[model samples]
Target: MTGEVAGGRVPLPQRTAEARLIVVARAKRAEDYDRVLDVLVEAGIRSIELTLTTPGTFERLPALTDRYGASVDLGVGTVTSEAELARAIGAGARYIVTPVTSAALVAQAREAAVPIVPGGLTPTELFASWSAGASAVKIFPAGQVGASYLKDLRGPFPDLVAVPSGGVDLDGAAAWLAAGAAAVSVGGPLLGDAFAGGDLAALGTRAEAFVSLCARTAH
Candidate 1:
């Protein structure tokens, strides 16, 4: 199954490498999701991930892309199963991320040359995913392990594209990137119920700061 989404697209690895910061927004409503998208766009954040667990994401991806695709690399996170992969492609997901590695899914992505970032926790698991053709291996629940662990992982897997997701914040985003992460995913801190609260301005500020912080660390 070729993995190309509706539009002929750029590959995910290129997008991740170019994106200094990736914002993962988990929201319960379309309005909230849109609000977060707006903030991220306004703040010059070019990469955004709307997790499958986020309510209204499936309904919102297309519209969001229609409006923001020119400036953003829109993606779906926490994706599992071939059905979700097909749906995400239909919704114009430019990138796909999963909490675990699946060979079938990797094959599906590779068929179309689209990027697939699979999650893995251990050295063995991470390398396994890499060997399976994952564009990047996500260190899920990274906050629990901390940036120091990333430093250690890189020592052995210097060429690996390790993305530290979950519990990552603006303060640690730089550290992760500096440690050789292709990119870092920041959520909770960027949205933090602000969307549900309808606080777009606050969300915008947070997004801008996070972008700025990532930029600073990247250089």
Candidate 2:
């Protein structure tokens, strides 16, 4: 599972099944982040994205990676700058995600031989990111446009791999997948009230629901 893109060979992280359901986690505290991630992993969610906005995220990456590296595919998200991208790679992130498409970010990922999922809304933006060598173009706020937008986008860029992020809930996961999305990135709906001291058991239930939804939608 290797391919050359922008003069660099794509790594396993860029070419694996982990992308099918990327769980985005944003916590106010690192401890809460760890707790949520542990529960998610135990619930059978292997792909996890830790947002840079979370406090102490960068500092905790090493230990997090060490603790779950074997069973989890850990990635860093919400990266908006080249410096943050560098920090993520240095912290041993398996993949990198951004909320905006940046040619510089794509180039940096190419240089580091890491996988990057850059965000975009319009078709032009998505194509631009793909042209710049993004492993996958993330359709941020996908809920705004819904699955039909993804279906429409594929009509022109059939080869483009897209991951619908933001506001995607269990009810809509299958629709997104059916619309030709390579995967889906979920946050709040999937996390429920876990970040605000909600029940871990409840979070686990939601995680299982998502996992089940993805399984049923798998082609």
Candidate 3:
């Protein structure tokens, strides 16, 4: 089940399928990024994504990685360029996720040996991303598509590892899992500003709720 990537050998799919809880924090300041990551780690959200929206994202990413990379699956989202990809990798990004699929970026991630989860909407986009070597396809704004859509989608593309992103919540997580999603990525809707605003206890509570729901559905 283990596969080799550019960075190193990634564990088998079974091990990676811990019903991920990816917290994507958006901000225009490094302080915000710090707050979100700190809370996420404390709340036990081991996988975190720092979207490239903050002014000092590049500088902050490495610092965060240096501090937490050993225990966290730190990654970057909304990545668009080869330079940005390199920067994220240098900063110790364990994975690369994008809002849109790009052949060049996917290729670079492959070279770096990091799993790339590129964004795709329609069936065409999903398959295209898979064909381009994407490890998983993120269905951005998946709220509009709904869990039933995934159920129907997997019927045809059974091997596709779909990750529904944007607007996913605890109550709805099970539906997505039952629909056959490999994992789910939630943003503000799950890890609200309270968590991003320095509320560790609240974040931890929310993390537990999310994990509970995902675990329940996974079985």
Candidate 4:
């Protein structure tokens, strides 16, 4: 798939499925995004999701778009309300990601021509999001359910597109992809101390590691 929809905007599903790894970033401060994102982009990480839990997400999103629009797909994650969703889109987020399943947000994103991936744990919640026009459903806390859960999900909903998020380590990411996950959304394990006094050089190394690993499983 080209990943683009009616408005020429690349849908989230196509992008994530192709990239195979969505780096979930959290920073204590907003300005830290510049260096962190720079390291990730230079390391060949194509898709990055900045969370609302971080400060200055809405404020700095536009600048981030201008800074690294081509090399990386910049999106907002940890969204919970329609207002936050609206702000994210207005601030130049290419896509939206929620930590919970909200069909209202999914439907709104569909209407706006922006692909959204909403999180859910149960089959019912996931199916509701997917059916509601979600670009892809996020299988939250994927480590808890294990890769086999996705294999099971395919039994009832063969076409269910899932991005396994939350607690997915490097090996877990590979395992999930092997189990047929559309992509893997990874945070802490990949990022480590990059946000704090952690070594950015090592962060770049980890970023490259995950990117290389994910690329091996590309659809």
The top-ranked prediction according to TM-score is: 4
Superposed on all Cα atoms, model 1 deviates from the true structure by an RMSD in Å of: 3.5
Q: Please provide, for model 1 over 1-219, each residue's C-alpha lDDT reduced to its tens digit, 9 standing for 90 to 100.
A: 224433322235445567667788777766666656776788788888888887788888888889998888888888889989888877888888889868778767766667788887888888888777777788988988888888888778886778888888877887787777878888887777776676778878888888777777663
1-219 in candidate 3: lDDT tens per residue? 113652332321332367456778777686666666666677666677788876677778878878777767777888988888888877777788899878778777776667788898899888888777777889988989899988888777887878899889876677788788888888876667653355667777888787777767664
Q: Which ten residues in a row have the lowest lDDT in candidate 4?
A: 1-10
- Top candidate on lDDT is 4
Worst 10 residues of 3 by lDDT: 6-15
lDDT of 2 by residue, 1-219 (tens): 123554452433632354378899999977777888889989988789999889888999999989998888888999999999999999999888999979999889887788888999999999999888788899988989999998899788988888999899987788999887888899999998899989999999999988888777776
The reply for model 4, stretches above 4 Å from the true place, is: 1-10, 13-15
Encode model 4's per-residue lDDT on 1-219: one tens digit a residue: 213554323356455558889999999978998888888988988899999999999999999989998677888999999999889989988888998988789877776778789999999999988877788889998878999999999999998878999899889989999998888999999899888968989999998999888889877
Clashes of each: 0, 0, 3, 0
**What's the distance in Å from true for residue 60, model 2?**
0.2
Deviation from native of the Cα of residue 163 in model 3, angstroms: 0.6
RMSD of 4: 2.6
lDDT of predicted model 2: 0.85
* lDDT, candidate 1, at 107: 67
TM-score of every candidate: 0.89, 0.93, 0.87, 0.94
Ranking by TM-score: 4, 2, 1, 3
